[model samples]
Target: MVTPTESIKWKRRPLSTMGQTYKALNFEESVLCSPTQYFKRYIPDDLFTSIAAYTIIYALQQGKSSFNLPMYWDTSLKVNVFWENISRDRFLELRTNLHLVNNLEKPPENKDKFYKFRPVYTAIRKRCSDLPIEENVCVDEGIIPFTAKFTAKQCVRGNQVHGESMSSCCVESVLLFQVLKSQGINAVGTVRQNRFGKNLPFSDDKTIMKQTRGYCEEITSADEITMCKWLDNRPIVLCSNFVGKGSVDEVELWNKKHHKYVKVERSEIVRKYNHAMGGVDLFDQLISSYIVFIRSRKWSCV
Candidate 1:
């Protein structure tokens, strides 16, 4: 049944409160016997060979002879080996004819800009997706970062999304949850306040703050999506289909006012979310730590 988010009454509990202890699946079954087997998951040997053959053939077509090497090469008495047994001119000749897809069998350029790069792109995406999907999938902001200035970013305004901005990326969580529900996969993720949908009542930040630390509340949409707001150092909202505010537990949180760590309440939803999303939080931490801090007025300065 297609239930609207507004039609479902706000419930303070989970859709399923079954006391199932969390079990994390190990990688033993997904593991390959050897390094070669691991490597084949993304790039199979046959696919690699086909790519090499097509690329080489295209290079031959670009220059029937290696005489057209760039003037930058200087064509001096020095022998600059471009790639063992291949010279600058020969490499240029090969590069000019390089084809990820066979040049003869490629589709129209307008149909797909990825025609030449499709082979490698499809291989990795398809192979990785072939792995088993976990039930408690931790959904995070899946936006890839790009800070480089480019012509495409400017040209695509109002046409399609090219780069992700903080506001733009955070604004679409509600719809993301709904789509994941249709796939029959469970999801738990932190959602922006703006994405809470409509007609749903939630206490304002001031009201929530007035309550004791760890005081929590939740509401389930008519469609079974649950949103929980919990207080610790600050109020955080977690949206889920698999869990919500259940039995409360205490966790040590730094009390900035007191300058000490104190026990704060954490419910099942918060605990479940933190546990399931530990890897994602770690990944975010790693990437943020290494981000290039270049000062640029343009958003595309990646």
Candidate 2:
């Protein structure tokens, strides 16, 4: 019998079945829009299924974009039928291994640096590009709650699932800023949470608080790095600890004890980014005005 490692290797072996079919049909690469003619390869059934499933899910959640893994995966589907023939086990295994569904955080080394959710971000920036230079183009992160979906872990003190929280500025802050830059505007990201490491000085009263603290901190660090990259070119990017949503009650009575978080996102942005002329105009602009442009109409993040 083939071992798991052997099976994995066998599944990954590149097959040229798709090339033959394409050649027979005289299909043009430009018509398909793939970068290379060799893009039409027959990936394994299991691999194909994960790509197809995640492509759809990513498009739904993030939007379509250039760096989206889902688009790459899903594009291969029309040329091949491997995804349709895969067994359930093979499909699940492929999904879990590829880090598509996020059952857990990806290892630091494995995370792709260039994998930006392009489509959603492009839409947001394009919408705000026509606005004046001092308009507020706020940026935020939307974390998924996979743990919350699992009931078994609910009993754990720190395992509660909070509703969607949008930090005023996150590490993704820098990437978002770059998107704005492409559209003739400036932006930035920041965070201040401590969720990755162990034995931190965070309060234990609320597990979500502690986790969020670390998470935010990491985001802050990432934003700082990104901000430094654009310091010389676009010195007006903003960073802040503003959060848009918070949970007042936990799912269970014991879990719920009246906990909440508030954000001063507008003020924080003015303090960090320098274009608003002493923070007054910027703050008023955000508070008194609304940019009605659609930020991400397409599925760039898919």
Candidate 3:
């Protein structure tokens, strides 16, 4: 029998199988598109693999203009090996025909919106599942900017760019939570205030200042799921199964009246939430700073 204190060990392996699966699915989609076309002339599996690698490298190497024929020209970037190997026409052809999953088959009702990128989605989820769970795991949402029309696209108000509103679950946040709990990993996250029902155990009459400065409430369900709600500028709520209730810490808060920073007693839940909630946001920020400016209709490619 496994002890509660024991950690789960993850196996490390190459993701070549995922690449092979992608190639097969993409080739099938391409074949289905042009069944009458000559098989001998069709793009080979090796060429597709090369194209995938080239695309990733191109995205990494930034250029003045977006990914276009001109960007890969000799005059623009001298002695470019990638551009010389693949012709412009062939690149465009592959880009146009690339497909992750077959559209003919109807997806399940719940996953219909995300059917287009289902293959890539599944691959990512599998990769996440294979990773070892950390003792302290944080969950948060990250938006993928996609102006193109897609069923799963969500428009977040106040964001400068319009795009799909993917929640933390896209990165397997909920799955990680469940898995980590089984291994005794602590998980914390800031959830939407409205997620709580109207019949909250805590009173709604609390002032915003009182809540934001320092206030914590512990809630437990019949199933023994421990959740916490604390006040800090706004109502910050979290669900942490491993953390104990009533733990407090001192945090610095700005006082508008006195025009100085004041130390206030804050709950441990608030401190942990503030410290751990930025993993996804930090990732989004880093990618946004250096992301390739290429535009695409496909949400997955974007």
Best by lDDT: 1
- Write model 2 residue lDDT over 1-302, tens digit each, in one string: 11221121111111111111111233333555443432323222454465556655554445433232322224344645554555444544444333234323346666543233323334445555633443444443333332233222222237454423323444532334334434544443433222122332333434333332212111122212121111111122223223111112212112123354332122223344433344545654673464232223222221
If candidate 2 were superposed on the true structure by all CA atoms, what would the RMSD be? 23.5
Model 3 lDDT, full chain set: 0.52
> Which scores higher on lDDT, 2 or 3?
3
lDDT of each: 0.66, 0.32, 0.52
Candidate 2 regions off by >4 Å?
A: 1-134, 141-159, 162-173, 192-302
TM-score of each: 0.68, 0.19, 0.59
Better of 1 and 2 by TM-score: 1
lDDT of 1 by residue, 1-302 (tens): 44554455665546664324445566557543687787787888878788768877766676554344533444455655534355556555555555567777765555664466667777887886887665455435533344355332322356454443322123255566667567755667777766565555678889999998998888876667788888876788888766778778889988889999999889888888887777678878986787653334242243
> Candidate 1, after superposition: displacement of residue 117 in Å?
3.1
Clashing pairs in 3: 211-231, 212-231, 212-232
Please report, as a residue range, the 10-residue window in candidate 2 with the lowest summed lDDT: 14-23
lDDT of 3 by residue, 138-235 (tens): 55566666666666666677767666665545322234444555564556565543443345465463653465466666665432334566665666
Off by over 4 Å in 1: 4-40, 57-98, 103-115, 130-136, 139-184, 285-302
Q: What TM-score quantifies how close candidate 2 is to the native fold?
A: 0.19
lDDT of 3 at 149: 63
What are the RMSD figures for all models against the true structure?
Answer: 6.4, 23.5, 15.1
Q: What is the lDDT of residue 173 in candidate 3?
A: 26
Between candidates 1 and 3, the TM-score winner: 1
